[model samples]
Target chain A: MDTATKPQQIRLSTTPSRADLEALKIGDIVYLDGLIYTAREGVYKKVIEEGADLPLDLPAESAVNFHCSPAATVNPDGSFNMGAVTATASFRFSKWIGPWIERSGARIIIGKGGMTSKDYREHFVPNGAVYLTTVGYGTGALLGRGIKQVKAVHWNKELGLAQAMWVIEAANMGPFIVDGDLAGNSLFERENARIAANLDKVYEGTRPAVLRRFGETDDRTDEVIG
Target chain B: MIAIETIQETAERLMEKAAIEIPEDYLDGLRTMANTEDGDLSSFVLQAMLENYEAAKQDRRAMCGDTGCPRWYVKMGNEARIEGGPIALEAALRRATAKSTNEIPLRPNRVHPLWRTDHDNNVGIGAPEIEYGFEPDGEWIDLVTVHKGGLFGTDYRMLFPSDGVEGIKRFFLDSLVAFGKRGLACQPAIIGIGLGGSKDTCMVLGKRAACLRTVGSRNSDARIAAMEDEFKALGNSIGMGAMGFVGKSMVVDCNIEVGYCHTGGMQMSVHAFCLSSRRAVARIHGDGRVEYRTDPDWFTDYQRRESVEWTPPQSLSKSA
Candidate 1:
């Protein structure tokens, strides 16, 4: 918590500290005070789906990437809660949280759920970025802290909360684990990469789940998984 | 003389009045929690509810547009009499539907999945309730037309890394996981379960469950009441908060509708929102008349320079 002697710089370097990362354990709490970028389904996919580059210039350095699409709320106690759900559907559109974390000059990937990608690790280790986990269903609690403000840019009204860059300021948030880490020996990264390497084999070229019940479409199940 | 009530009249009445909002008791409880929850994240989740209330009021939009599949449940009074209903309730309702659709612009959400999408209409097979009977109670025929909307991202079966609950609890956890993966769009989402009913009935109720309700409200059944409490607490433990980011994200509300099950008919649906969720309901007399509430306050306006954001501009701790 040193403030003046050697203030923690919101580093923008492509590489993070390996020593700082390996020193961490599974449940070790961290208060990351730095530059982080938030994006959800629409913004995440438009990067590749639309074959576009990073929305505002990519900063794959010490930046952090948060995968979330928050709704606005005002608590009775006068606090604010934002980002109260899961980012899986956005994941359905694009699994860019990891890649963007790397490309956005971020060394931190934060959100609920798990990510399994080798490229993510390859990038994470050299850059010293790590994946952190927030509780799976505690979304409402996350937002209850009362949002001070969500500094958002590059918004898509049509996409609503789906595609946008949000700067979230959290309060008293804790215990979000490092699901994936830059130690290069993380469990999350290894499995994700293995899956990605053979996604085409496992899912690609597969027929669409046309005969789904409730008379729904299988447009997503058959999409080209990245 | 068939003095037809112009469809326009019916719609305005419905929008302005008939749509049934969740019971007062439900919202009041949520207000209490939003005010009292000591948990920081708990307060944030509650705030989302406040926003919903404001949005539905000011804009006059369906509080949550999954305004649901409109199911007309009719209860006739013992002395209930028909004036000129030679105009089928279904037809009258259809006319009202068309008017409501245009006015609220409730996204042309309905489409026959089996065929090409056509929302040029609102009535479909067995829609607006062609099925009904006399209650013989003269109970003033309180017509409960409930609208349930789509609240899912993936099927419960589609929840990956199979979880560890069994029986109803398994069902509940599966719902949470499915809700996380599919129900919620990675945002603050309310999960409502239809405990028992026909495939159609449960689905309708399930949608309504998320329509609008005060948090902490419960069913009369002891089992369900307990289940609601457990599901909510357990869900929060999952740390899927507002936008499913992470925190003590509270499920603002979860409603369960139960009816006699008919052959493998149990359904659960989750209507998730990144925040600006809009859903509301009202009631009308058999005459299609209603006494709607006066204009209330509007929701927090969407600033041109602002929108829903998962992360903040500064560390939330700045104020903490």
Candidate 2:
């Protein structure tokens, strides 16, 4: 490991100020404090598409929305047991993210893979939001340890445990890498560009398959996500 | 005879082990990658993962929140007999799966594909698939459970004989590069390639190659073993590491498995056992002795034999 090039780390609240977000670079690391909530396609469709009322106050109470489903269960006694908490891939939620950010006032979106730069520029920049990708696409046990409490759960009966909204209080909860900044700069995109430069050399001996599938791209620069 | 109650009890234990413990082979592989990885952000990710595994074990928690879809591979010696038979054995496995899901608090990941009905347990229609294999030996059974991530990092392609090894390499790179972007396929993974079989078997072979085999294990055939070594190097050389960052740690290891296919066509499938490569194995003897270990050792010489007739190895025959 290169100690000299290690990224800087900071502690920030879930409901962070615009200045706090603006100061963060794409490669910096962050650990979160305050309240965060879990939401994904199920929550998005129910609230945004079906027009369900917001269950909790938005940025006033919490501004971090995690694209995650924890290894959790509701016990017979009605207490929640959340074992490990990790984020899901955020790019899959691209369709709902714009509206979600607008309605929920989410200042920090934590997830597995960061969304595309286009998404960051369009949805996050205008809203003063940034993206934090979970380390290892997880660090679930470490993140789980940081959970001060499972504050509440919503829509368990309607959507089940995996899709229901889960409110949690975090205390230094992360090892999250800043994938998108307030300026819409993306760490993944920068890394991709540098890695792309070596593709031709690495693929020198391999030949393309004779039977190519439809919608396949020969261009190495193109991303798989839409 | 192996008792049904014993089977279920052992299976439940296996589930917990698979979820919480980072197998030694995979941990060692990642440790090696972490030491050599120079990409700053990627190195940080690797170090955190190392800590995460320790935390999981110490806290007795699942390593990843996405605990993945639990499945089973049962290999029984031909002389073995169960208390109730195959039906009872299956029920025991399913019962163990559901019981562990709640006890371990695994994210009930399985649901009806269309209806989206979640049982709140990992068990559902065709969920926690159980596959069977047999060996011509003693009265003990080996149970292997793998909680592999269900989504992403696997693909199948069909190529004619004319396509050759270069074509195979192309498809392999395509899968890695495509899913490797932003670490969707979760690189620094155990990349498994199934070279031949019908399409469905190709997928099965590839999946087994990833989940059942340990890191540094090779295919029995010399040519295929060589390809395994080469592919591991090729994947690491892609200039990508954990989370698709710029580093040379994309592949921890590569494993290849092959099956006989149609003469004119070659079917191929690729699978990645991710950073949390969760698998556990146990052997339960008829006398009630149960031993636990990480290695599945599923692909024995008999499992890969090409001969039309069964012939005991000289050593085994002499011992008998």
Candidate 3:
């Protein structure tokens, strides 16, 4: 139950309310809810390359996506148990993100890791999709919020605990921010810019590009703000 | 000195010691992980362990209700001779069996062979094993007590190949398949993979090591580290974050121990600790005097409550 909407077909800001967007800027917080279908690296790669069957079939306009895989818990009947964890990230499969979101109706990508692209701005914001990030290693607390229901449409598997397709109905599951907003800006983008600018000075030209942005903060730095 | 006793007495003593000692290890390991992870979840696990320990101490109860019957491993000292004890392993262990079942804790598990609920540990004839170490490590009667945590309904595992480049491609699919069945019992886990062991050994080794003293430590090898990095990344890539929520870093550190063999056989053991990671360990001496270990107050406090996250140390030591 989804309808295709191209990025150009929709115009919205990071914050949900129209008035809230009127006074928004970078570093602001936002929350998204409502029918977000599920997909992971398997589904993303398939839609991009293989055109394989998908777990859900939903629209992208204002829809959200998740990057999580939860573990198991004690079953109700005292039998077996497992977690409905989130997917990881939406970036590594960057090649297909734009095309698929354009085709499907998903507009937000919820993940924990990092994703980067050269034409990210034009590809994401101009197309009405924004990138969101959830707290890492906070599955138990997130699930403690209590799920309303689980939708199986567009669900995907093949990534295991690290990746699974689950349509979870979550309320107030947040403190997550728009790492990438509708205007082609993101934490990945800004970090890449700073890295590019400081490459010769800070990294000494010998640092592995992969070493940037991952556990690179000074020891005296703050303990995870927000 | 007390008069010489029969073989049953020796096994009985050993069995008694195992029950107490094994729980100590479980408790201490949880504390160690709590000490290092410093995350909100680890804190809760640590807290529960401490509470279990305290509950046992306050009333001299078993560290935990389960006190999973010990896995008895023995080795005959080169010069040591046992004239009075029961020769067979099982017979000897039964004498030392606990008559005290003070609220024996029940785990969310079932018997594998029969696929039925058997909580008492007394149901099966050879419920646990009596493997002997071949090494002549001395007559010191080294009773290596293993704490068994997989209780069936809660711990389901499978060993599959490391998915190629698509990054956790196969595992994600399998998990989805599992989700389709809605058969998993816990949320948030610490996955341990033992690569290269002969099928059963690989899984057993990984799981056993996972329950080893170094619960919070990273994998010891580099190649395995690479796999962990990928799994974490791939899991993150696929949005397998939070406890089933659209978050990040769902599977904590996937601890894998590698064993080399002439032929290739890989085994991956997945034991879901649930959000609770309910486990404890105790080590008992010949006299049945037990020495206990586990995370301190703050860590233990966090282990019980989901909202708690304490700052754990980078290195692990008993001092914690």
Docking class of 2: high
Better of 2 and 3 by TM-score: 2
Model 2 spans > 4 angstroms off: A1-4, B315-320
- Candidate 3 at residue A77, lDDT? 53
Ranking the candidates on TM-score from highest down gives 2, 1, 3
Question: Can you write out model 3's per-residue Cα lDDT over B208-241, one digit (the tens) per residue?
Answer: 5444423345544566567666554443333222
Over B206-318, each residue of candidate 1 has an lDDT whose tens digit, in order, gives 54454433345466467777877766766555443343333344455555655555444344444442233333233234455543332111100111113455233342321
lDDT score, residue B3, model 2?
Answer: 93
Winning model by DockQ: 2
lDDT of 3: 0.39
What's the i-RMS for candidate 3 in angstroms? Answer: 16.0
Candidate 1 lDDT tens digits, A35-128: 3456655565666467666654445322556665443322356443342322232234234544654456666666654444454455666666
Q: Chain B TM per candidate, please?
A: 0.63, 0.98, 0.54
For candidate 2, the per-residue lDDT at A95 reads 96
Best prediction by lDDT: 2
Q: Measured against the native two-chain assembly using Cα atoms, what DockQ does each of the candidate structures obtain, in the order listed? A: 0.04, 0.82, 0.02
- Arrange candidates, best DockQ first: 2, 1, 3
Per-residue alpha-carbon lDDT of model 2 for B195-291, expressed as tens digits? 7889999999999999999998988789999999999999998999999999888889999999999998999999999999999999999798999
Poorest lDDT segment (10 consecutive residues) of candidate 3 chain B = B295-304
